[model samples]
Target: MKIRVSDLISRKERSKKIDYKFEIPKFEFEGDVITPVSKCEVSGVITSDKDIVIMKAKVTCTLEMNCSRCLDTFIYPIDIDIEERFANNNSLENEDVIIVLDDILDIAQVVESNIISSLPIQRLCKSDCKGLCQECGANLNKESCSCNNDDVDIRFDVLKGFFDNKEV
Candidate 1:
């Protein structure tokens, strides 16, 4: 997913467009699994300006995820538009810039960053999805647990018996 910026770096603008499809495998990040379905299609225009490369990308893909409530697998479609600026060699004094990449910027990396950025702050199957029960470990959405909510503490009874025996 690397694009050669030779033409863009020459300070000459070119009306070049290319279409590409890429597949991103399942990966784990910060204990969350990211499974992307199908290869993302990224088609865009790369324009060369004075000491800068202008890129406008339109990408489409699907993200596969499991419901935290019912543990069911689900897919979410993703479509995004990316506009970025890249600096040419010896164009700027400092390397640290708002630009994405200065040399042979990896398109895959760009797409990955975009996908990660677009992710939901919190993902749920539904708005009222009942999570799993703590005691019986049952999915409350499908069925209810038999455990009583007002159960008394059995440990306190054991302590009471121990205190009674000490009195004897």
Candidate 2:
């Protein structure tokens, strides 16, 4: 996962080829609202092409999260494809290359960056999901509760009484 900068190739030096592989434990992140399960698998190959290095990575994992609306726990799937390049020697980017590393580049850092960066700003189970009812504390998705629906808003009772008092 770690590479030696001196071992890499540069226009001035002659280290033309490099390859490596390794595995690390799953990562965990804790937030105030939710704690994501750390079950991830990452693998990839690094190929050095002269002054440029090509890194192809595939990550697959699952996270246990609570549904934003109902607060029910559910399994969430994760999959991502990422490609990164490191450049050797400080040269202008006009030469069809990018990201030249100083001496060594950390693959774990790259993978971590991709995972955290790609996450949705706001995680939600669905677009049109109706959350749990504040009154009676019932999940709106499952079944209707016996609790008075009008209890959702007390202000509506004033209107309800006015209409009831009207003689038809």
Candidate 3:
């Protein structure tokens, strides 16, 4: 969502409080689709300190994601704290600083970035999920596999033959 900072820029007020709620459509990242289950809520206060505008906001949203292990879909809730600074003038050349343009501040990019970074690298359906069995592509969590459990690696066959020929 976009927030107007015209009043603050005009020096009418030293600070302004903002509270916004918006819906985020499903977005794809790295071939994975992330869909939000509900509206995202953001509430914060923006303060103008000299030529800089500082914003601190709390964002909360619930997302639907697939488990990396079992591919099961689940709902994940996220809460993130954001602190950003915008330069009212062009004197600041830091790459990390966001420049305000036309007395408008767009927070959609910031919110999307924070949510993506907050996601876990590996998502599991459960703590001890057995996952899929390599032998017959069976789900180990649901049933036991009848595949041979004592299959030996071919790389160790030479060593096995040498040991078998020697008497203990």
The lDDT values for all models are 0.73, 0.63, 0.79
lDDT of 1 by residue, 74-123 (tens): 78788999877666566463744335345676778877788778877666
Model 2 pairs whose backbones collide: 5-103, 87-99, 87-100
User: 12-88, model 3: which lDDT tens digit per residue?
Assistant: 67787768888888997667798999999988988877767788999999999877766677788989899988875
**How close to the true structure is residue 148 of candidate 1, measured as C-alpha lDDT?**
69
TM-score, every prediction: 0.73, 0.61, 0.80
lDDT of 2 by residue, 2-66 (tens): 77644655345533332333343444444524344654566666666776777777876666656
Q: Evaluated with TM-score, which candidate comes out highest? A: 3
Error of 2 at 119 (Å): 1.9
Q: Sorted on lDDT, highest at the top, how do the candidates line up?
A: 3, 1, 2
Q: Name the lDDT value of residue 56 in candidate 2.
A: 76
State which candidate, 1 or 3, has the greater TM-score: 3
Give the worst 10-residue stretch by lDDT in candidate 2.
15-24
RMSD values for the candidates in order, in angstroms, are 6.3, 5.3, 2.8
Q: What clash pairs does model 1 have? A: none
